[model samples]
Each structure stands twice: as C-alpha cells, then as structure tokens.
Target: MLGIDCPKPKGRWPTAPFDPRFPKQNQTRNCYQNLLDYRPCVKRMRRRGKSTQPCEYYFRVFHALCPMSWVQRWTEIKDGTFAGKI
Candidate 1:
C-alpha cells in the first residue's frame, strides 16, 4: 500500500492533511510530502491565478507525490482526512 506500483483512480483524488506543528511550513512540507516535489506546479498554479487555498495546493501535492495506483487505492483507505493520515 505504501509502494509506488499501486493503481490510482480515474476521478479526482482527495486532499492530504495539514501539519499543525509547523504552520508556516505546513503548505510547503505537506505539498512536498504528497506530490514529492511540487514547487513547479505550485508556481504554475500561482501563475494561473488560482485561489491559494491550502487544500487546493495539498491536492496538487498529493497528485504529484502519489503514484497512479496509490491514488486509486487512496479512495479506499479513507484514513487521510483533515484530522490526520500518517
């Protein structure tokens, strides 16, 4: 379930949780954790003038970090809600 070969779903994936301890770094860290490295995507989103909601960035980060298979399985897990995932 933690590997890179999981099957991702077709629809949009859910968002990852935010880290409370590091509020300032939460967006960057969470996005990195989810998308592996979303600096470019974040920049693109910013260029596109998208709303800078944490959840939106988090979802993009998730798409970047997770494999296609894992994205599919994520819907089944239902464990990574706003409350917590790890």
Candidate 2:
C-alpha cells in the first residue's frame, strides 16, 4: 500500500457506508491505512469545533486505507487502547 495517493470523495458524506464484503469497489478510500493516518485524523477532527467532519470520517473509509474498526473506535479510550487522547 506504499506510494499510493488515492483521491478522496468530496462534498457531503455519503448516506451509506461502502460494503466491506466487496472491498475493491471501495478501494479508492484511503483512510485508516495505519495508526499514523487514523489517530491523527481522529485527533484533529475531535478537536475541530462545530463541524461534521469527525462524524463523517470516523466511520467513513477513504480509498480503503483504513479499517472500519479503526475508524469506529473514535470514542474508545483507556489503557491498552488502540489509539486515544492523542
């Protein structure tokens, strides 16, 4: 997955999530590829005030870079957690 710069969809978030069973259709989604990409996006989005970006990207996969669980764990915290309070 290195050297890949996929394009993210623009405009309002999609009303539904891309089906994971058929990932190629959602392969363009370049989100949650790594902890580096996932944690920081979540961190900045959480810090952003009065915005829908967080909710949108939290569960939204971009170019299939990140996993759904990684995005869904936005609110997950505490010891031994994946990535939190960063």
Candidate 3:
C-alpha cells in the first residue's frame, strides 16, 4: 500500500455564533444587524488607521445568513441610500 499523509480537517463550517440578543429561532434581524455592524466597523477602523481584520466577524456572520442578492444590492448602493448608519 502506498503511504501518504492526509491533512486533518481544521475548524467547522463558517457560521454565525449564537448571539444572546437574538436568542429566538429567527435570525433575520441577526443577519441585518451584522451587515450594519460590519460597515461601521470597517469605516471606524479605517478612520483610525487600523487593520480591518476585526470586522471580518460581522462580515462572516451576515454572509452566512443573508442571501447573496440582498448583500450585493445593499453593498452596491452609496452611503446616502443605505438606511443603516455605515
């Protein structure tokens, strides 16, 4: 038998963690909040001349929950059009 080393799997699938604020089964608001939070985090970090790495958490959460089309459309609009305070 040919000997080969297989790499062990790393972490679990990229999904949002349970947020105490949104304990209910519905995650619609959770997804929306993440999207809103992500933008402001990026803006704030950039304004402070800091890395945007921390904002990735919000980005990951929203992407996991929100539909692609909605994310795309929301992102495409300028800041003025976005209802959220980004």
Candidate 4:
C-alpha cells in the first residue's frame, strides 16, 4: 500500500456551504450566480468605503465551484463581454 501507512494531514479544506437558493445537485447555476454576486458585492462595498471582507464569502464559493478555465475566461472578458450585471 503505497503511502497508506503515512498519517493523513490534519486540516480540512474550505468549500462552499449549502445554499438554500441552489438546492439542486447540479451546481452550475450556483457557481455562476456566486461569481456574479461577488463582483457587485465588492464594488458596492468599495463605493461605500466599507470593508470588502464579507464579499470573500462569495469569492470563495465561486472559486470552489467554478472551473479555473471558466474563471480565467470570464476575468478576461468581463470588462465588456460578460452579460451578468456586476
């Protein structure tokens, strides 16, 4: 048993918590919505001179659920091409 005898790490990885709004098994829509929500939350907080720390929740959720490629693509095109309101 290769490495089976080794002790496992003691840390838990962070992931998105259950959202009642997205109760379905397929999380594609959840991922997209979180991505959309994160931007506006950050923008609004910045505009109001409030701390953006709370917006990290949405960022973490979308980061965990969305594919890196999709995130990268959206980041590249979000200035003009992204349809979701930020």
Candidate 5:
C-alpha cells in the first residue's frame, strides 16, 4: 500500500504514481513498508479467494523496487537480534 496502489494488475506490469500525499515509493522506507503491507494481502487474498492464477502486483513491485538478495538480508536484519540496531 504505502501510498501507492496498483492498477487492477492486468498481466504484463503494474504502474502507480508516487503519491504526493506521502513519501515516494522510490525511497527505501516506503518500498519496505509496501512489502510489509503486502504481508497481510497474501492472507486476505486467500480468504477472499486467491489470485494465484497470475503474479500479483505486490510481488511485481517488490522485485521492481528492490533486489531479491536484499530481501533475504532484510529478513535477517528484521530478526530480533538486529531489531532497532540498524
């Protein structure tokens, strides 16, 4: 979410403008926050009816916004041992 909402997410790609109401998505904070927002989306999608038929917009933005390896490091960095230390 993070102030950026995807277009109904047809198939090829997802595009959303940086929300002028808040910090831009290109920033690290907003990008990671977007990923966090997506954490709930997966479950909601399953409960409401999954959309596994196609790649969802959250993941598309995740890859577009940051590298996969960075995600691994983010997981490690978010662990209790590293929390608030960064």
Candidate 6:
C-alpha cells in the first residue's frame, strides 16, 4: 500500500549527475505518464506473485527521482488522500 504522507528530503542531499541509460528516463513527465510507464512493471510483478509490493516499489522509484513536492502529490493520489486538481 502507498504511504499517506509525502517523503521529506533529508539533510545533506547530494546532487547526482543525470545519466541517459537510466531505466526510468521519462519519470519527469506528469503523473499520468509516470503511471503509464509504471503500470507494466506492476502488472508483471503481480503475475509473478508479487502483488501490490511492486506498486510500492514503483512509488519509491518515483519518490527518489522526482522532487519532494511531486512525490508528496503523487503519494497523496496513490494513497487516495488527494482530492484536488493535479
């Protein structure tokens, strides 16, 4: 299941250089697009008996690549806690 609250950026966050070979290259797009890319892996995981765990892992990946604010909104929507416009 998704978490209710957004992830808070911790101290001493180091900026990493961008790499084109990263699997989640288009993660900077809107939530809808992000969901599109994530859904396939999620389905495959479920078919392999992973259940919702894979979805949670996707959320973690999104949180890691996206800004804290974006992660908060995404988490809210994923957890059914967001009811406003995106």
Q: Pick the candidate with the highest TM-score.
A: 3
In model 5, which range of ten residues has the least summed lDDT?
Answer: 77-86
Whole-model Cα lDDT of every candidate shown, in order? 0.47, 0.44, 0.74, 0.75, 0.52, 0.50
> What stretches of model 1 exceed 4 Å from their correct place?
1-53, 78-86
Identify the runs in model 2 with alpha carbons over 4 angstroms from their true place. Answer: 1-36, 62-80, 83-86
lDDT (10s digit) by residue, model 1, range 1-86 = 32223233457755555566447733544544554333334445567888434434555546654565855555444433422323
Model 5 root-mean-square deviation: 8.0
Q: Put down candidate 3 lDDT per residue, 1-86, tens digits, no spaces.
A: 00111123256646788999899999999999998888778778878999877887787788788887987777677646777765
Stretches of candidate 3 above 4 Å error? 1-13
Error of 3 at 8 (Å): 24
> What is candidate 2's lDDT per residue for 1-86, written digit by digit as tens?
21212235676655435556446755433353433454456546556754435444443444234555743453354434544233
Q: Using TM-score as the measure, what is the rank order of every candidate, best first?
A: 3, 4, 5, 6, 1, 2
**How far off is residue 27 in model 1, in Å?**
15
RMSD of each: 12.1, 10.8, 11.4, 11.0, 8.0, 7.1
Total backbone collisions, model 6: 0
Which ten contiguous residues of candidate 4 have the minimum total lDDT?
A: 1-10
TM-score of each: 0.31, 0.28, 0.80, 0.79, 0.49, 0.35
Error of 6 at 46 (Å): 2.1
Residue 2 lDDT in model 5?
Answer: 26
- Tens-digit lDDT track for model 5 on 3-79? 22333535565544464534654556655655665645755665678773333555566556666697556555433
lDDT of 6 by residue, 1-86 (tens): 34323235455544434445454746465434444446556656656877555465444455556777865455445543444322
The alpha-carbon deviation from the true structure for residue 11 of candidate 5, after best TM-score superposition, in angstroms, is: 8.2
